[model samples]
Target: MSSWQIGDITVHRIDEIPLPPETGAWLLPGATPEVVARADWLGPSFAGPGGELHLAVHSFAVEIAGERVLVDTGIGNGKTRANPAWHDLDTDYPARLAAAGFAPERVDRVLLTHLHADHVGWNTTRAADGSWRPTFPNARYLTARAEDAHWAQGELEPSRRQMLDDSVEPIRAHGLLDLVDVAEGGTELLPGLTLVPTPGHTPGQFAVVLSSGGRSAVITGDCVHHPVQLSDPALGSCVDVDPAAAVRTRTGLLERLAGTDTLLLGSHFPAPTAGVVRRHGEGYRLEPVPSA
Candidate 1:
């Protein structure tokens, strides 16, 4: 079990599955094999010998204050996604969450970084009657108000609409979804959990900031999908809604994080997912901190 501690908070990594090499190739075309090979600091953990990136689908089950919180549910079981890899997954995600002490009904809050198919797939589960229902019936599912506003103002493609219908809409229909306005600074959801605005990957994307005592850790949402972004924030993903804005958000975050003790946890990073930023040449790199 991969776990980490920050002051009084305990964060558990609830594994869903490891993403395939193709996922890296498709999501980040800019991080080609040649480019990866050039970054020697990436190997042995962040990248494979063949230069394929290492990524995983998992949720952070956090015990903070008195809340049982779940952060970013991974590509869920039975989700019919546009991406082939995310389509119709049947992983033991629920069991994993339970094992990590975050059974669906026991969750107090479901924090979504964005509304992407992967991030929201576990929002609902298919009922026996074939209707999607809120997975955490007792928890309040929260996301940036900006995310819903963006979709409401525009027409989503069929696939995008399908994802919402199965995952997001059901939660909203059941009155379990809450749209929180994350200001320029951030909105503290609870004692130690704060929603920090991080747009661009999606217009209303936000990273979760967990703090307690004097220690702090950040859950990097989609703002920085892979560690390669630490090398060059300009290396954006193919699905970025605003490429330039994503770059700016990432660069600013990394610049501030560099040389700090603040723990940087990559939402999709493989193993040793928590690290502290450090200046490396022109950009930055993670000084890996192994989980307990």
Candidate 2:
């Protein structure tokens, strides 16, 4: 478990699992061995010495104002995903959460950045009776209206269809789904936490911004998947719905975040996911928090 404290809010990263090199390359088409070697800073953490990249499918547990809010539930257990690697996962995610002191029933709010399979999996779980049920029994599952409508058009892939049925629809049926509009400025979720539109990877993607005691941090949701993107803002993910738009959103985010004290918490980055963005030669670089 990796964690960071921002003012009164404490954020914990619970890893659902780590992605292998082949899977990472499939997700990031531009990331070849030669290309990865350019970002020397990724060594041993985000990238192996042999240029194999490691990515994490994890959730951020944000404890603020006495409410436990989970950002982006990682791929869930027993999910019948289309991707072979993700299909029928039998990991101990709930046990991991409990190990980190975040019991399922104790989670009060669950925020989905977008309706991607990996991001929304744990929204619900399969009961022993084989019925899909909300994992967080009492938490309100927050989703963007635009995201739901976009996926509802039936244009999504087969895996996404399964995701909607098992992860998303169950939350709605459980009377815990809250659809909100992701606007330009921001949508305040809690007192100090806000959801800001950062589309590209998905039509209605939003990143969470936390500001408290004059300190700030951004919980990026696929807007900047890997730290290498900081050095090459133009590097786009193959999964991006709009590659060009993703570049623009990513570069804009990097430009504004560079040289700031704000912490950058990459959603898919490997262990020690929190970092600071700094302006490099022409683009930016991620300065990860020092290992303890």
Candidate 3:
């Protein structure tokens, strides 16, 4: 388990699947190999031997004050997703969580930054009876009200809708959902953990802020995916709903976070995902913390 300490809270990474290296252009539209190659800092961790960008789909276990809060639920095992890469995954995610000393029933809260299919895939799991059920029966699911309302308008593609029906709706049906407003900042999740709005990738996307012992960290849920984006804040992912707005949100976030003491926990970044964003040249760069 990859773990980090920010004040009193302890964060552990529970990986569901690791995405293999791919050319920068394949993942982000404007990100060509030439563009990303300039980021010399990404080598060996965020990027591979051939300027291949590495990524992972995983959730962070945030433990603090007798609470075991899962930041985001990764793509669950045995599910059909529209995206082929995520379809019918059968990884030992629950077992991996147990290996990290966290059982499903012990989770207190399943907090989702948005309702993206990847982020909420493990909200529930498939049962032997061929029915889907909440994976963490003892936990309450938390998401933004705007996210639920956005899907309610039926603007998403069929695949996303299927994600809602299978992974999201089951949580609501089991009376384990709490929808909060993230328009003007966000609510206090715990005494020291706050949800701050970082919209544009999704209508109601938010990042978690942890403050304690004069140290801080932010769980950036899709606000920024890979370290390459930090080199060119204008570059956006093909999956971004509003590319232009995403840039604004991302640039603003970098401006506020760059050179600060706050550690950034990237949701989809590869190993050693926790880092400090620093202003570089005309953009920014991630200085990864040495892992334990």
Q: Give per-residue CA lDDT, model 3, range 1-292, as digits (tens).
A: 7998888988899998887555245668676667768988888888776767888999989887789999999888777886677889988899989887779999999899998878999999888898889999999999888877877894767888788999999898889999988657567878878998877888888899888888888999998988999999998888777888889999999999999988989999888888998999999999898555
Give the clashing pairs for model 2.
none
Each prediction's whole-model lDDT (CA): 0.89, 0.87, 0.86
Worst 10 residues of 2 by lDDT: 283-292
For residue 83, give model 2's deviation from the true position in Å: 1.4
Residue 207 local lDDT, model 1: 92
List candidate 3 segments past 4 Å from native: none
lDDT of 1 by residue, 1-292 (tens): 6999999999998888888888898899999988888777898899989989999877888999899999988888888877878889988888888888888889999999999888888998999999998899999999889998987776889999998888888999999889989999989889988999989999999999899989999999989999988887899999999999999999999998999899998899888888999999888989999997
Tell me the TM-score of each prediction against the true structure: 0.98, 0.96, 0.96
Using lDDT as the measure, which candidate wins?
1
Clashing pairs in 1: none
RMSD of each: 0.9, 1.3, 1.4
